[model samples]
Target: MVADVNVFVGQQRFLRLIDEETWATVPAVDPVWVDVPVTDYTVRNRPKRRNGQARTGSYQRRYGANPSGHPSGNLVTPLYGFVNEDLEISLAQLMMEWGFADHEVKFPRSKTAEWQYVGHDNDQRHLGLRVNTATLAGSEAGIVLTLELIGQSSVSFTGAASPPADRNKLVEFLFEDSTFTLGGTPLRVSQFQWSVQRNLDVIYHNSHNPISMPKTQFSETFSITPMKSNKTYDDLRDAFGMPELAGQLVLKGLHNGTGDTGNFTVLTIDFDRLSLIDSDESGGTGAIMNPLTFDVLKPDTADNGSAMTWTEAA
Candidate 1:
């Protein structure tokens, strides 16, 4: 028999985050386009053996036996994505589930939102998923969102038979457009990546299915390449030497419409506040580049406000 040609595309795949633990609620918006190759999934099973005694023809002998295995397993799935937008609603929800705080911001001509890290000394972070939403349009508005959901029961799939087109396709239809700014000064960027991870604990009680839930501590890592400078390099060098001196790092991404004059949509991804605890200053074989790593943290100015921000404007 021939394999079905209904391959899962970027558009067919959707990601959502919710506050409730039942895995029941689904967001109204469509999921942001995610790179499936990077998203990983796994299932582990535990098996037991049996031993028995048997009688031989001449003398009694001990023998080994095999028995049917029981259902003892855990499930794990990790998702990764690169969003070019100013804000990701699902990420805000995930931040909250992981003990972070989310804040809404209003700008003179923009709509903005922020997520702040607010866990005490140490707490395990959490994440969940669901999918539905309008396809993303325009040139530079997206935010990377990663989530991990675990359940003891079997897998479940729900969606319409004829879903929407490939979201990646729509993204490609538009032109290449994005702007990166750091501390109000436009910075040249060679590459950038956003990563988030969450894990759940699985416990087996006196039942066939296992119980799994998210852990307490979850965080993000922002990696990018910035030009080497005397002051900047000295700051990073000093921070690495003195962990306590590493201050907050800020970065932003602004997305405008496709060159068309009629289009008026604009989006911004702002990482106004983060912990700059790590840095790498390597004189590359070809071009010497200074790569920076930012560990997201709570805003130093306020306890309830946000450290990272996103904005969408007409």
Candidate 2:
């Protein structure tokens, strides 16, 4: 199943925070592009068929076609595809440069408390999350960000058994049942909702001259959603190539809000205020670090396994 993952950002926030005139002149930040391969399989059963027949005789006669066995089982497979094209920023740089305190920033782990199922008929499933600095460390500079799949827990199906009939209900259940833990604490699933109307604001002012004629501020809100699969903690850890989950947030914008921008700007926005609203009530402080530095500790080249698949068995 494909996981419905959604990401959202405030566009005006960046524009309000940066110099309006210089906004266009800012160097473009290159996005980290990666292709994820998805696969799916299905099973179906066919009932036996009978033929018509008739017979007659002096006394009595009757004839009927023999029933055939069930048709041969078949497997339907497809290569599901997705692209991770989101502009990420560095949390640390944003805090220091933007003059905003850590308490003013909020990041989302998942879009909705509901999990998203992906596939031809909603049978396939996927999951995603917005990992920031807070997920990495309690209080320290050097640390790694990792996602762990504690284990498979029992999940209940309360929605309709047929497809398209219970789509909304299925979506709701998808997010409600899925849970995660950070630093040994189980965070509730309700903490993933975010405002879709918000944007990134950047305020640029002269440090020395307070009352200057040339005052500029830029604001722009960016939206980030799970494009394909809602990755688990293990999936994320594997993607970043870290032994443990502990890293900062990476903003993938630098080209004037256009993902097409061939350039990229990296900023680190620190997480000052954090709380656990999920099953694992775990919270802590986190900061943004250079991607190069983060990668040095954990290389980007890692194995991303096939997307998880599911099917109904007879």
Candidate 3:
């Protein structure tokens, strides 16, 4: 007999962020943000194997027979997209899982204050995630997350369960319209790429499963057309040797504004300690462009708090 197979599309997928306040509990809040650029979501649980040696000195490996080991699991998802005002808010929540603090501050003259996201130590903060696809047949299918650190076992798994009502909730940010700033100058961006990573240190115990701690870092690279009299190139050259002379990149989004009293979404990234990791100033037949890369550094402190900021529009 033949079987029917179904395939999934890239764009029809959505990622919802849930703040699981505690371990193994269902989240209660509505998804922080839906329809994030989640390229792939994977769950893996692989355990080490052991072989048995008999009296005859012959080795035999039996599958699931010896059961003499602990296992570890991992859930991995890669997200990518164009940077904008609204998306920055969701991105901030995602970064928080990798260990960042969400700081809310109210502007003196405004009703709503801007938000500040700072890098945080890799504490034992557990989070929840949901990945689903809107199918062509108008149905939804995906995995629900409920995971806890396996005691003495370094395993991770997405527990199959409905999210609860008391889950930690992140603020909602929507996309309306946005503007971009490169090197403090206003321009529409053509390319933007950024990534966040956690460096995990595994700790092993004498008679228990190993545990892992994480340290997080991020990097970004982008390309843009050269503007007439643009000093970005020269500025980058000057900053190349002097790390303190790094620049800034800002993005702002506006909503429901007739004059100025509408809502605003803002993001600011400082490159003060960033190194010019890569650069390309092509002299080809096309419009001259500059593509640059930076190694993100913590500015002026061990916490590296000056890397980025997410400010809510007043």
List clash counts for every candidate, in order: 17, 97, 11
32-61 per-residue lDDT for model 3 (tens digits): 322333334332223445455445544554
Query: Model 3, poorest ten-residue lDDT window?
Result: 107-116
Q: What is the C-alpha lDDT of each candidate?
A: 0.35, 0.22, 0.34
Provide the TM-score for each candidate, comma-separated.
Answer: 0.48, 0.17, 0.48
Please give the ranking of all candidate structures by TM-score, highest first, separated by commas.
3, 1, 2
Error of 3 at 58 (Å): 6.6
What lDDT tens digits, residue by residue, belong to model 1 across residues 153-272? 332333222222333322211113445565566766555554443333444465444443334334555566666765574575575543222222223222224222322223334454
* Number of residue pairs clashing in candidate 2, backbone atoms closer than 3 angstroms, sequence gap of 3 or more or interchain: 97
Which of 1 and 2 is the better model by TM-score? 1
Give the per-residue lDDT digits (tens) of candidate 2, residues 20-74: 2221221245422211111111111223344444444344444344232211111
C-alpha displacement of 306 in model 1, angstroms? 5.8
Identify the runs in model 1 with alpha carbons over 4 angstroms from their true place: 1-21, 24-149, 156-160, 165-169, 172-176, 229-231, 239-267, 300-314
